[model samples]
Target: MKILVCIKQVPQKDAPLKLNAAGTWIHEDVSYEVNEPDAYALEEALRQKEKHGGEVVVLTAGPARAQQVLREALAKGADRAIHLEDEKFVQLDSANTARAIHAAIAQESFDLIVTGLQSDDFGAAQTGVLLAEILGIPHATIIIGIEKTDTGLRLKRELEAGHYQHIETTMPALLTIQSGINKLRYATLIGIKQAKMKPVRKVTWADVESKISPNLQQIVRLYVPEKQKRTEMMEGPAPEVARKVVDYLRTAARVI
Candidate 1:
C-alpha cells in the first residue's frame, strides 16, 4: 500500500492575525505550524503504513515556509515528501490548488491519498473533493477509521448528530480525514535526525504552469470578523419580566 498524505502549514492556532495593507489576507509575521487536521491525517497514514508494510509519502503546496509542514510530517514517519513551492500557490482557489496538486502527482502511482477535512485558515473543504474529481477516483470525506479489505478498503466516516457510517471502496482512492480520528505522535529525536536525511523533492511553479488550470475564484477582500456586544435589561414584576423574557427569546434570540 502506497499512501500519500497531503498536509498544509497554517498560522498557529493562537497566533494573532493582522490584515495586510491591501486587506487581502494576513500579515506574514505570525508563526506557522502544520495544520491540525493534517496532523491527524499524517498520523493515520503512519498507522496504515506500520500495519500494512508500505511507504507513507506526504505532499504540500505552498511557499518555502510550507516546507516546515512537510519536514514535520517526514519527522513523524513519512518515507518521502513532495513540495510544490511558490508564492502564487498560496493564494490559489480550491480548484486551481487541486489542479496544481494533480499536475504535480500526475505520474505517480498510489494506493490511496489522504488529506485533512479542510484548511484551518480558509475552511474551504473543496480542495480534496476537487482533487478526487480530477483524479477520477473513489473519494470519501470525514473518514475516521480505515481497514484493509480483501478487495479494497473499509472506511468509517463521520456523520451529523454523532453518527458514523462504514463504507467500502477499492484502491487508488482519496479520503479527507476529520480531526480527532487518531491521536497525533510527536517526532522523536532519532526521527528528527533521520528526517534531515529524508528526501524532499521541491517542484517549482514554473515546472507545472502549463498543466495548471486558470483560476476559477477570486478573493475580493479578506478581513477579520468584527467583535460586538449588546445587552438589554428588563424591569417589571416577575410575571411581566417572564413574559418579556419569553418574547425576547421568540423575537430576538429566535430559540423558540
Candidate 2:
C-alpha cells in the first residue's frame, strides 16, 4: 500500500490574529504549526502503513516555511515529504489547491490519499472532495474510523447529530479524517534524528503547471471576523424567568 497524506501549515488557533494593511488575510508575524486536523490525518496514514506495510508520504503546498510541518510528519512516521512551493500559488482557492495536489499525485501511484476533514483556518472542507473528483476516485469525508479488508477498506464517516455512516471502498480512494480519532504520538528522539536524513523533495509550481487546471480563483480580500457581544437579561419572577429561559433556548438559541 502507498499512502499520501496531504498536510498544511496554518496559524495556531489560539494565536492573536490581525488583518494585513490591505485587509487581505492575517499578518504573517505570528506562530504557525501543522493544522490540528491534519495531524490526525497524518497519524491515520501512519497507522494504515503500520497495518498494511507500505510507504507513507506527506505532501503540502505552501511557502518554504511550510516544510516544518512536513518534517514534523516525517518525524512522527511518514516515509518522506514533498513540498509544492510557489508564490503565485499562495492564496489560491480550494479548487486550485486541489488541482495542485492532484497534479503532484499524477506523477506517482498511490493506493490511498488522506487529508483532514477541513483546515482549521479555512474550514472549507472542499479540497479533498475536489481532489477525489479530479482523480476520478471514491472519497469518504469526515471519516472517524478505517479498517482494511481483503477486498476493500471499511470506513466510519461522522455525520450531523452524532450519526455515523459505514462505507466500503476500494484502493486509489480518498479519505478526509476527522480530528480526535486518535492520539498524536510525539516524535521520539530517534525519529527526530531519522527525519533529518529522510528524503524531503521540493517541487515548483512550474514543474507541474501543464498538468494543473488553468482556472484559478483569486481572493479579493480576507478579513478577521468582527468582534461583537450582546447581553440581555430577562427580569421576572422565578417561574416566569424559567419559562422565558426555556422559550429562549427553544426559539432563540435553537440548540436543543
Candidate 3:
C-alpha cells in the first residue's frame, strides 16, 4: 500500500491573530505548526505503513514558511514529501486548492489518501471533500480508526453526541481523519538527521497555474468581534420578575 497524507501548516493554537491592513485575512507573521488534525492523520498513515509495510508520503500546500511542516513530517516518518509552494496559495479556495494538488500529482499512483477532518484556521472542512471529489474516489470523513482487511479497509467514524459508525471500503480511497486518532510521535535525533536527507519535491504556482480555475470563494473580510459587558438587576415582586425574565429571554435573548 502506498498512502498519501495531506497536512497543513496553520497558526499555533496560542498565537495571537491580527487582521492585515486590508482585513482580507489574518496577518501571517505569527508562529505556525502542523495543523492538529492533519498531524493525527499523518500519524495514522505512519502507523498503517508500519503495520502493512508500505510507503507514506506527505503533502502540503502553503507559503514558503509552510515547508517547516513538511520537514517535520519527514522527520516524524514520512518517506518523502511534495510541497505546493507559493505565497498566493493563501488565497485559494478549497476547489482551486484541490485542483492544484491534483495537477501536481496527476501521474502518481497511490492506494489511499488521508487528510485532516478540518483546518484549524479556516475550519472549512471542505478541502479534503473537494480533493476526493476531484479525484473521483470513494472517501470517508471524520475517521478515527482504520483496520486493514484482506479485501480492503474498515473505518471508524466519529459522529455527533459521542456516537461512532463503522464502514468498510476498498483501496484507492480517501479519508478525512479526526484528531486524537493516535498518539503523535516526536522526531528523534536520528530521525531529524535522516529527514535532512529525505526528498521534497517542490511544485510552484507557475507549474500548475493552468489547472486552477479562478477562485469562486474568497474571504472578504476577517475581524475579531468586539467584546462588551452588560448587566441588569430586576427588583420587584417574584411574579413580576419572573414575567420580566421570561419576556427578556423570549424577546431579547431568544433562548426560549
Candidate 4:
C-alpha cells in the first residue's frame, strides 16, 4: 500500500495574530507549526504503513516555511516528502488549492489519500472532498477509524451528536481524518537524523500552473472584531421588573 498524507503548516496555537495593514489577512511574522489536525492525519498514515508494510509519503503546499511541516513528517516515519512551493498558494481558495495538489501528485499511483478534516487557518473543510472529486475517487469525511480488509478498507465516520457510521470502500479512496482519533508520536533522535537524508521533492507552482483553475473565492478583508460592553439597571416592583426583563429579552437580546 502506498499512502499519501496531506499536511499543512499553520500559525502556532499560541502565536499572537495581527491583521495586515490592508486588513485583508493576518500578518505573517509569527511562528508556525504543523497544523494540529494534520498531525493526527500523519500519525494515522504512519500507523497504516506500519501495519500494511508500505511507503508513507507526506505532501504539503505552501511557501518555503511550509517545508518544515514536511520535514517533521519525514522525521516521524514518512518514506519521503513532496513540497508544493508557491507563495501564492496561501491566497488560493480550497478548490484551487485542491487543484494544485492534484496537479502535483496526479501521476503518482497512490492506494489511499488522507488529509485532515479541515485546515486550522481556513477551516473550510472542503479540500479533501474537492481533491477526491478531481481524482474521480470516492471519499469519506470526518473519519474516526480505519480498518484494512481483504477486499478493501472499512472506515468509521463521525456524525453529529456523538453518532458514528461504518462504511466500506475500495482502494484509491480519499479520507479526511478527524483529529483525536489516535495519539501522535514524537520524532525520535534517530528518526530526526535520518529525516535529513530523506528525499524531499520540490515542485514549483509554475510547473503546475496550467493544471490549476481560477480561484472561486478570495478574501475581501480581515479585521479584529470590535469589542464593546453595555450595562442596564432595572428597578421597579417585582412583577414590573420581570415584565421589563422579558421585554428587554424580546427586544434587545432577541432570545424570546
Writing each residue's lDDT as its tens digit, candidate 2 over 1-256 gives: 9999999899987899888888767888889999888899999999989988999999999888899998899899899999998765667788888888877767799999999989988788999999999999999898999999998899998899988999899988999999998988999999999999999888898977776665566557986667788988999899999999999999999977
lDDT of 4 by residue, 102-162 (tens): 9899779999999999998999999999999999999999999999999889999999998
lDDT tens digits, residue span 1-256, model 3: 8999999999999999999999998888899999999999999999999999999999999888999999999999899999999998878998998999999889899999999999998888999889889999999999999999998999999999999999999988999999999999999989899999999999999999999998999888887999888899998999999999999999999999
Q: Using TM-score as the measure, which candidate wins?
A: 4
Over the stretch 1-256, how does candidate 1's per-residue lDDT look in tens digits?
Answer: 9999999899999999998999888899999998888899999999999998899999999999999988888888899999999999988999888988998898899999999999998899999999999999999999999999889999999999999999999989999999999998999999999999999998899988887777778777886777887788899999999999999999989999
- Relative to the true structure, candidate 1 reaches a TM of 0.91
TM-score of each: 0.91, 0.86, 0.92, 0.93
lDDT score for candidate 1 against the true structure: 0.92
Each prediction's Cα lDDT score?
0.92, 0.89, 0.93, 0.93
After superposing candidate 2, which stretches have Cα over 4 Å from the reference? 212-217, 225-256
**Which parts of model 1 have CA positions greater than 4 angstroms off?**
231-256
